[model samples]
Target: MDRQPRQSPDFLEALSARSQDIFRRLVERYLETGDPVGSRALSKMLDMQLSPASVRNVMADLEELGLIAAPHTSAGRAPTQEGLRFFVDAMLEVGTMDETERDQIARTVSGGARGGRVEDLLNEASALLSGLSHGAGMVIAAKSDMMLKHVEFVRLDPERAMAILVGQDGQVENRIIDLPPGLTASALTQASNFLARHIVGKTLKEARQSIRRQSERQRAELDEIAQRLVESGLASMIEAETSTPTLIVRGRANLIDDAMASDDLARVRQLFDEIETQKGLLELLDDAETAQGVRIFIGSENKLFSLSGSSVVLSPYKDANDKVIGILGVIGPTRLNYARIVPVVDYTAHVVSRLISKKGEL
Candidate 1:
C-alpha cells in the first residue's frame, strides 16, 4: 500500500470550544465502552445546562461535517475515522506512566533480562507490550551492519567449512561455505588472522571494501590459498547479513477474545492474514522511521488496517549515533486507550534504543 502523509491539524481551528469538548467526550466514551454515545448521556456528563434537544442539534452539525455519525436509527453517535484523527492530533493529552508501569517496562526490557541477547530482549519487549495493552506486539529488529569482533573458520568436510562471526554486541552468527579445492588448515588460520588484524573494529561493509581493495592490489603478502579463503569467507558473511530484515511478533493470542472471535469472525480472520503476510505492516513501520516521535495510524488512515478496522501505535528506535535502525509498536482495535498506550509505546522505544546504544559495552 502507498504511504500517506499525516493530515494537517489546521481544520481544528474551525471548531468552537463547546463543539471540541463534546467531540472529545464522545470519542472518549466510545473508546472506553465501544458503544455509540447518545445526546442524553453526554448531557449528563457536561456541566452546561443544555438539554438533550440542544445537544441533538450540535450532534447534527457534527454529523454534517463528517466528524460523527449515527450507527443506527438512534440519537447516539460514534466518531468517524476523520474525527478520531482530529481528536488524536488536536485534543489528546498524553499521560505519563505511573510508578508501577515504569517498573514493569524497566524490568521487562532491561533489568530482569540483564545480559540477554538483543533478540531475546526484543522478544521480551513484544510480550510485555502485548500483555499491557491487550494487543498484538511487534518489533522490527535493526539489520544494520555490526562491528566485527572475531572471525573463525572450522573445517567440516573436504569441501565445506563453517565461518563463525562474533560481533562486538555479543551477537554470534554462522555461515557454511563450499570450500575451494585443496584448502588447508594453515590457510584457514591465515585467513582468520588476516580478518582479525585488518577488520576487527570496522563494520561489515567497511571490512568488505577493505578486503576487495587488498585483493585488487595483490600486495598483502598472502598465499593463494589464504587469499581465496578470505575472499570467499567474507563474501558469504556479507551476503548473509544483507538478507531480508527480521520481524518479531508476540502475543498474537491477545488479538482474539472469546467475544470478538464469536461476534466478528471475519475481521479476526483478516487480522490473522495481515499478521501472517507482514509485508504491509513492515512497510508502514518503515514510514514511521521518518518521523521524530510516536506515530498513530487510526483505522483507514493506514491501508493495511483498513479492512480490519484496527489501529497501530509505532515509534522508531535509534542507535548510539542517533540513526534510526528499527521500530517497535502495538496493534489493536481502533478504540484502544490512546492516553495510556501512547506513553507505553514511547517509553518502550526509549528503552530499546538505550539498550542498543550499550551494545558495544555488552
Candidate 2:
C-alpha cells in the first residue's frame, strides 16, 4: 500500500466546509489512536449536530476523492497518505513545546551549561529526540571540515592496519585500511610519522593536497611501501569524511514492540533490513531539507522509508557559518503525531546548531 500523494494540496480547497470538517476530524482521530474512525465516532467528535447517516454520505464522497479509505469490510475509514499530506500542509496546526520542554532540550544538548565535543553533542541530541518522540532518532555528521591534532596508523594484522585521527579539540576517530604485501613495522612507523608531519593543524582534504604537492620531491625521502601507506591512510580518512558521515541512531527499541505482534514485527523487520543497507537512508537524509529547514517524508516515493512503512521528520544542523554539515531527525511508523514531532525535530536542530556555533566561539 505504497500509494503516491498528490503533487499539490490545492485540490483540498474545493471540498465543502462540511466535507472538510468531517475529513479533518476523521484524520485527527485516526492519527490519535492508529485506527479507523466510524461515522458514529465522527458525529460525536464534531462540534455541530450531525447524524451518522450524514457523516456516512460525506465519508463516501471522501473515499471517492481518494482522501480516506476503508481498511476492512467495515463502516470505519482511515485517512489515506494523500489525506494525511493534505491535512498536514493545509489544515493541521503545528503545536509548540512548553517552556519547560524547550529548556530540557537545551540542557540535554549542551550537557548542562558547558558544551562537549561535537560528537557528544550530536549523540545527546539524538537520544533526547528518541526519548521524547517515541521513535528512532538519527544524526548524520561530517568530519572533513574538522582540524586535526594527530593522526597515526597501527597494524592490526599482516593484511590490515588502522588509522586513528584525533581532532584538535580532542575528538578521536579511527578507520581501517588494507596493508600492502611485505610491509614492515618500519613502514607503519614511517607512515605514521609522515602523516603527522603534514597533517598537523590541517584538515584531511587540506592534508591530502599538501602531501601530494610534496610527493615528487619527498619520493626519494621514503621507501615505496611507506609512500603507499601514507597515501592509503590519508585516502581512508577523507573517504570516511562527509560522503560517509558518521550515522548515529538511537531508541530503535521504541519502534520494535516487545510483544512482537505479527504485523508490527513484520514492519519492524522490514525497517531493520533497509537500515542495515543504509545507502538509501543516507541519501534520503542528504536530499531531505527545505528552505524552512524541516522536511517530512512519509511512505512511498522514498527508499528506506517506503519499504519500512515509516515516516521521517528531518532537519539539517549547520556550523558557525551556517553551512549544513549534518542532519538530524526522527523515524517511526506513519501513524506518528506529525503535529507534535515536527516541532520537536525543528527545535532540536536549532539547539544543536546554536551549540555548535557557541563551541566555535570558544
What are the per-model C-alpha RMSD values against the true structure?
A: 4.8, 3.6
Alpha-carbon TM-score of each model against the true structure: 0.79, 0.91
Model 2, 63-106: lDDT tens digits are 99898999867669998878777887688777888999899898
lDDT of 1 at 143: 64
lDDT for each candidate structure: 0.78, 0.79
Question: Which regions of candidate 1 fall more than 4 Å away from where they truly are?
Answer: 1-5, 8-13, 72-75, 148-170, 174-202, 215-240, 258-262, 280-286
Name the candidate that leads on TM-score. 2
Span of 10 residues, lowest total lDDT, candidate 2: 1-10
